[model samples]
Target: MLAPFTPGATAFGLAHVLAGALVLVSLMMLYQDRLPALVNVLALHAALLGIAVGWQAWLQRAPELYITAAIAIGFKAVAIPLALHRIIERLDIHREVETVGGISLTMLAGIGLVALSLLVMLRTAAQADALAREDLALALSVILIGMLMMVTRRNAVSQIAGFMMLENGLILAAAGAEGMPLVVEISVAFSILIAFIVIGVFLFRIRERFDTVDSAALDAFRGELQ
Candidate 1:
């Protein structure tokens, strides 16, 4: 789809909006209450991530980022979510998210993380361009939120999903950086995809042994219940 306008401030503003949308998607992923719902939203999140990165690529005329965007769209948006859905179906784990943190507290913590990202990026990337700074800050915020999801969620599948979000954040940051090598970017993307597939296989084994993919249940089997 064509951007509403093509010139200076409008393009910049739209790019900012796209990056901000990515951060919002990350925040939304934090509050997803069910496994299937979370996976579905992840597809959307990946699509948005691709769009945001593709926008950056267009603005900066970076052809390598376009490849990155294609990988995200093809693997992340389509392949991974479909694979995760099958995992959920096969494991019969379409249940509510098991979270320790209360909703209000979790949202507050996410906001604080975003604020922290802003402050940290501003201080550390003082010499970078403002647009890059904004993207990096939002990217960091997404990464932190993903980490929070992994810590708070009880299900191994949820943790995998969180890990994917974290990788998404890293991809966004790498896309924004000017000198990042194309080979390095492809390697990182495929590495993440491989890790995701490995986690899915592990989840299959987790289902057979533990009869559940919930980490608490697994821990209980080992007499390490927490």
Candidate 2:
């Protein structure tokens, strides 16, 4: 009778579904060109991630993790999107996102990344914790897809979206680990700092100098020297 249920089982299942949906959402975010929709979807993904972490905290009875969930809900899901939207309005660079790899190919690469994650996780985890093993595989898939989006997209804002998805994966990894004290706090602070620094330097500068924040233009500038 005691062997039927396991700790973190329900929570793990919930987190897996939520994380999987977010991964698909991130894929959609990658190919999106409409600024408002992109922002909305990213915010939604952040909210889902917060919910997953909060559910995990509740199931594990860990009050410390609740704080991380709250930060995810407040800062990432709400504040960051609002700030980014304001920046987009101020910059007035509302245009369709451009991509180097195109949508179909990017999707193919996403599939490949997912398959690779499954293969790697399954092949290497003989003695690992079950929840951790699943989380690692899912998180790595999301991270790889995010990275692929970053490389394929030519719009600065879309690239930022990709970066946020990568951060989401990192949060999942942190939550899945057994003894990662201060990880959530450090990650939140670091993310905010990175975003602030990049936004301050690049967002306005791109608008001012080139009248757009297209990555291709930036790359073209670099290519001109060679």
Candidate 3:
């Protein structure tokens, strides 16, 4: 038998479900090649994170956490994706995502990461708060998978998607933590803004110079210069 459904227990169950969804999306991102699909997946992950935050807010009876959930839904789930879509349209970089390594290998690594996360969390952090430990383990797995995506993908757009996955994991972890104020939420939003600015600038420069957003081609250019 499982734990009884107390108020916090119910919320914890919802958050656990959200974490599972986040991991699934993270795995999907590893295999997605089309720019539009990548964006959609990122949006889904963000929306799940928002749901987790909202559940936490309701269960914990913290009205302030609701504001964090609102920002997560509004800015990450909607605004960022819309802006990225526009950028893709204007920049004409909605081409196929190129990967340095094969898709099958990337997916296998992602699976390994997920398994490792669950095993490690179950074994080492047994004494920590259950939700906190789960969040930490899930966050690390997502982040590692994102890093693998970034390294194996040779398209700027896909790399950006991978980076967003990492951010989503961090948001999940934050949502699962207790007593985190709205300021932390604002800071996360601000960090995402800064990342977008940097990525946009970098993409523009890459596009302007090479007439392509293929990271492989860009790397070749750097090689010739050296």
Strongest candidate by lDDT = 1
Using Cα atoms with residue i matched to residue i, what is each candidate's TM-score against the true structure? 0.83, 0.83, 0.81
What is the C-alpha lDDT profile of model 1 across 8-77, one tens digit per residue? Answer: 7777788779878988988898878888899988888889988988887888888778877877788788
The 10-residue segment with the lowest total lDDT in model 3? 203-212
* Residues 1-226 of candidate 2: C-alpha lDDT, one tens digit per residue: 4667765566678877877786788777766667778888989988987887787677667778888888878888898888777767766766655656677888888989989998998678746887778778888888898898778765566667777888888887787776668866876685777468446735455433342467777778677645
List of clashing residue pairs for candidate 3 = none
The alpha-carbon deviation from the true structure for residue 122 of candidate 1, after best TM-score superposition, in angstroms, is 1.7
lDDT of 1 at 199: 71
RMSD of each: 4.9, 4.0, 3.9
* TM-score quality measure for candidate 1: 0.83
Off by over 4 Å in 1: 1-6, 183-203, 207-226
Q: What does the lDDT read for residue 18 in candidate 1? A: 83
Q: Give the TM-score of candidate 3.
A: 0.81
What is each predicted model's overall lDDT from 0 to 1? 0.79, 0.75, 0.74
The predicted structure with the larger TM-score, 2 or 3, is: 2
Model 2 C-alpha lDDT versus the unseen true structure: 0.75
Which 10-residue window of candidate 1 scores lowest in summed lDDT?
202-211
